[model samples]
Target: MPLLRNALTCSLLALVSHIATAAEAPAPVQSLRPLLTTLNERLNIGDLVALTKWDSGKPIQDSPREAQVIASARTLAGEHKLDPEDVAQLIAAQMEANKLVQYGLLAQWQAAGHAPDTPRPDLAKQIRPQLDELQNRLLRQYADVAPYRRDPNCPVWLAKARQGLTHDALHDLALTRATGELCIRAAGV
Candidate 1:
């Protein structure tokens, strides 16, 4: 009876430890808010300064339409009798640019292949979901602070791109541009 009791105690202890370990494990990082926030802030400062310099007297609603942004800023300055608000437009444009870049990359990736446009049933099934999740996070982060820059279609493009990148491809992109110079030098080209 004593031996049986000891065995039962050991089994319970083992079970408890297993459960504790499982419960205590840390979760993965899913959001890119921190990353996007930094970029958004930098873009904002640049735009606002430029806009303020072109001071047009009109309200923000009367934004100028010009081929170039600076030209638009100048036009806005002339129309509104005040400079464009650089910080405000900068934030808006940065967000827009990021979404555009993400979407373009995603479209390029999707066109490359990997089970076109289907969501994964399970997180562990493939890294594509993780990539989608990261893109979503970055987009969400951009939206939270700079809502005006939001683009719904950006995710679609991001999802496609994320799925397309294999580890080797990632490594190559990271190194290729820098290495291209070396290759040219070695070849005397």
Candidate 2:
């Protein structure tokens, strides 16, 4: 029951810290308009305003596994006392990973010179380390902000508790999400 006990304690601590932090000095939230607009233009997707939900756990494609993943994320967030900042960090990490993948794809495409829209195999090979690095960053930042203590090597998810995170980082988070989305769309993922 150590894991469960630890999770409960972390959750309570996060909630308390958030309340105390708010009472002492309110944190500022940033606007992501430009980032959204950029995402729409780059991805040729729907209006940024239309996509209000920031939960990455939402079904990207309908599947039981996706639903379970989303639920698991929610449970972990509840148990571990994650906050919106944690979620932003997670998205930001994902965005970075997406960029590396895109770059790898571009490199492969250029090497081939087959076409402007050709696919490449290097993307799969290169994205793993980038994702790993992002995961590490998320864990470090989470440990810094939240009440929970994360294992140095443990991989933690960040997209669950993404609310009330109002800071300059929001811009970066949006850009990262947009970039990742663009990369995925470009790569047809």
- What are the C-alpha RMSDs, in order, of all predicted structures? 19.8, 17.2
lDDT of each: 0.36, 0.36
lDDT score for residue 103 of model 1? 38
**For model 2, what is the alpha-carbon lDDT of residue 60?**
23
lDDT tens digits, residues 1-189, model 2? Answer: 999999999999999998998677522111122223333232221112112111122222224533443344444453445654444444444444334333443444447763343232232254333333433443344334332223221112222223333233434354345333211121232
In model 2, what is the error at residue 133, expressed in angstroms?
Answer: 23
TM-score for each candidate, following the candidate numbering: 0.20, 0.25
Model 1 weakest 10-residue run by lDDT: 177-186
lDDT measured at residue 120 in model 2 versus the true structure, 0 to 100: 26
Runs in model 2 lying further than 4 Å from the true structure: 1-81, 115-149, 152-189
> Candidate 2: lDDT over CA atoms?
0.36
